[model samples]
Target: MDARYAIEIDGLTKRYGSMTALDRVSFRVERGELFGLIGPDGAGKTTLFRLLTTLMNPDEGTAAVDGLDCVASYRQIRSRVGYMPGRFSLYADLSVEENLAFFAALFGVRVADNYDLIAPIYRQIEPFRTRRAGKLSGGMKQKLALCCALIHRPSVLFLDEPTTGVDAVSRSEFWDMLAELKAKEISILVSTPYMDEADRCDRIALINEGHLLAVDSPRGIVSAYGERIYTLSGGDMYALLLAARRLPHVRRCCPFGAAHHLSVDADFDAAACRRQLADEGFADVALQPAESGIEDVFIKLMNHE
Candidate 1:
C-alpha cells in the first residue's frame, strides 16, 4: 500500500450465490480525504463499503484500511474504522443517549472519553436525548446514528447513504459536518445516490450494476463529457423531445429538471435545432447551453455500458 492510501482495494469481487454484486472493483482513498462511492441503488456501493468495513468478506481479491488487511486483520480494522450503515441499525427502543453509549461500550470506550469527538453532532439532538431512537425525526435519527459511529474515535469513517431520507436543510447540515470532520484529518468514505453530493468529495468512483464506470474528481468526470449539452424547455416537452430527436445531429436527449438536456454530434447546430422544433409546430421552444454535471456523466456512462 502506498503511504498516502488510507483505503486500498484491488480486484475486489463479491457474489451472492449466482448473483454478482461486485466485479473486479478497485480504487484507492487517500488519508484524510472525503471520498464518495456514487451510484444509484443496487450499484454495489453498499457491498464495497461492507467489504472494507469487514462486515462481510469478498469472494476474491483483497483490500486494506490504514495498512491492515480486511480479511486477516478484520478485528484491527473494525476497531479503527467507524461505520454508519445505510439503514437505521441502532436500537430503536433505546433513548438517543443510550444508543450512543451502547456503541461506545461495545467498542471498549466510554461515552465521556470520546464525548468531544461527537459533541458537535450530538449537540443538535441533545435536547432529544431522552427520546427513543424510533420516535426521533429522520434527520435526528441520522445524527444519532452518526454520533454512535464516531463515539469510538475511529481513524476512518464509512457512511453508507447517511442522507437518504433527510430533509434538504438537514442534508446540507450533514455535509457541513463532514467538511469539519475532514478538517480533523479523519479519512471518510461516504456513499450516496445523489449526484450533487459527488461534488463534496475530494474524489469519486462512479459505479453501476456491479461494475466501475469512472473514477475521478467530480470536475474531471464532468469534463470527460465529449459533447456539448443544451437544456431545451418549451410547451409540450414530450412532443418537443420527439421532434428534437428526429434532427440530424441529435445524439442523446433526456429530461433534466423542467427541461430536456440534449447531447449533439459535432455537426449539430443549435439554431437549426430551435428552428426544427419550431417548424414541427412545437410551442415557444427555448434552448440554452448547459454544463454537464455528475448525473449527466453517470447517465452517459451507464448507456455506454
Candidate 2:
C-alpha cells in the first residue's frame, strides 16, 4: 500500500472457469503518470481495467487505486476514479449535454463545478450539445464521453481503448486531450492496440495472452531488442517474405508497411543475402539495416513466449 503510487497491483489473477484471463499480472503506475497498457484485443487489458475500477473482482491477488483497496474500499475508489470503457457506453438516446449532466448528477456534482477542467474538451462538442450521442460521429462521441468522465474530476482516469474505431484526426486530438489532462496531474491509464500510441506514453506495459511481456519507457523497450534487423523491399511482398524466412541466418521476418523486417543472427551477411535472393529469381531486391520499433519488440517477445 505505497501512498506514492496512484495505482498498484501484485500477482493479480482472474479466471473464467478453466480460462485464465489475467495471470499473475503486476505493475505500478506513479501518480500523474500517463501509463499505457499496450496489447491487442483479448490481452486482458479490459479485465485489468475492470478490476482496478472496482467494477469487477479479481479471482486472486489484490489491487489498490489512490491508496484505496479495490475490493474493500470500492465505494471510495469508485468516487476517486473515472473510467471510460472500450465501447461507447454512454446513453445513445440522450443528447450530449444530457449525458454530461446525468453523469455529473450521479457523482453529486454539477458540470459547472468542473467547467474549467473540461472546458478545453467540451468546447469542441458544445456546439452539438443537443445532438443525440448516437447521432454523433466517432470522434464527437469520444469527446462527449471524456467530458462526462471528467465532470467529477477524479484523481485517476482509466480509458480502455478509447481510440479504437476512431478516425486518425480524432485519434490525434484525443491523445492531445489526454496530454492536457496529464498536465493537470490526473493519472491516466489508457489501453490501446496501436503500437504507435505506445510512444506517446511516459511508460508502457506490453502484454499478450494474459501475460506481461515487458514494462518500460518506449525507448527502453526498443533498446531491449538484441538482434540485428534489416528491411527488405522491391520484390513481390509475399514471395520476399517466404524467401527471407527460408534463409538460415534469418530468425524472424514479418511484413512491415511496404517492407519486410527481418531479424538475423550476428553473422548475417548482407551481400550474401541479396545474392541469394537474386539467385532465387527475385527481381529488384533491396535490403538495408533498420532500427527496431515497439512492434518489432512485441513480435520478438511473443515468439519467445
Candidate 3:
C-alpha cells in the first residue's frame, strides 16, 4: 500500500469454474500515470479490471486502489474511481442530459458541480442533449459514456476498450481527451485489444491467454526484442509464409500488413534465404530488415510460454 502508487496488485488470480481467467498476475500503476493493459480478447484484461474496480473479488491474492484493499474497501474504491466498460452501458432510453444527471446524482453530486472536468468532452454532445442515448452515433455514445464516468471527478479512471468500435477520427479525439485528463493528475488504467494503441500509454503490460507476458514502456519492449527480423514480400504471401518457415534458423514468421515479419537467429543466412525461396518456385521474393514492434514482442513472449 504505497502512497505513490494509485493501484497495486499481487498474484491476483480469477477463475470461472474449470477455466482460469487470470493467473498469478501482478502490476502497479503510479499515481497520475497513464498505464495500459495490452492484450487480445479473453486475455483476462477485463477480469483484472473488474477485480481492481471492486466490481468482483479475485479468487486468490489481492488488489488495492488508492491504497484501499479492493475487497475490504469496495465502497470507498467505487466512490474514488470512474469506470467505462468496453460496451456502452449507459441508459439507452434516457436523454443525454438526463443520463449525465443521473450518474452525477448517484455520487451525490450535480453535473454542474464538476462541469469543468468534463466540459471539453461534454460540449461535443451538448447539442444532442435532448436525444435518446441509444440514437447517438458510436463516437457520440463514447463521449457520453466518458462524460458520465467523469461527472463526479474521480481520482482514478478505468477505461476498458473505450475506442473499440469508433472511427479513426473519433479514436484520435478520444486519446486527445485522455491527454487532457492526465494533465489534471488522474491515474488512468486503460485496457485495449488493439496493439497499435500501446504507443499511446506511458507503460504497458502485455498479456495473453491468462498469462502475463511482459511489462515495460512500449519502446522499451520493442527495443528488448534483440532477435533479427526481416520483412518478406513480392511473392504469393501464403506460399512465402510456408517457404520462409523452413529456412535455417527462422524462428517465427507471421503476416504483418503487406509483408510477413520473419524472426531469425543470428546464424540465419540472408543470401541463402533468398536463394532457397527462388529455388522453391517463389521468384521475385524480397527480404529486407524490419523493426520489431509491440505485436512482435507479444507474439514472441506468448510463444515462449
lDDT of 1: 0.89
Instruction: For residue 205, give model 1's deviation from the true position in Å.
Output: 0.7
Candidate 3 overall lDDT versus native: 0.91
Clashes of 2: 0
**Whose TM-score is higher: candidate 2's or candidate 3's?**
2
* Clash total of candidate 1: 0
Residue 259 accuracy (lDDT) in model 1: 93
| Best-fitting candidate, scored by TM-score | 2
Order of quality (TM-score): 2, 1, 3
Per-residue lDDT of model 1, residues 1-305, tens digit only:
56468999999999999999999999999999999999999999999989999989999999999888999999999999999999889999999989988998999999999888888989999999999999998888888998999998989999999988777787888999999999989999999988889988999999999999998888888887535888899898788777777888777888888999888767878887778777788868888888888888888889992
Error of 1 at 105 (Å): 1.1
What tens-digit string does per-residue lDDT give for candidate 3 at 78-145? 99999999988999999999999999999999999999999998999999999999999888898999
Query: Model 3 misses residue 231 by how many Å?
Result: 0.7
Question: In terms of lDDT, which candidate is strongest?
Answer: 2
For model 3, where is the 10-residue window of minimal lDDT? 164-173
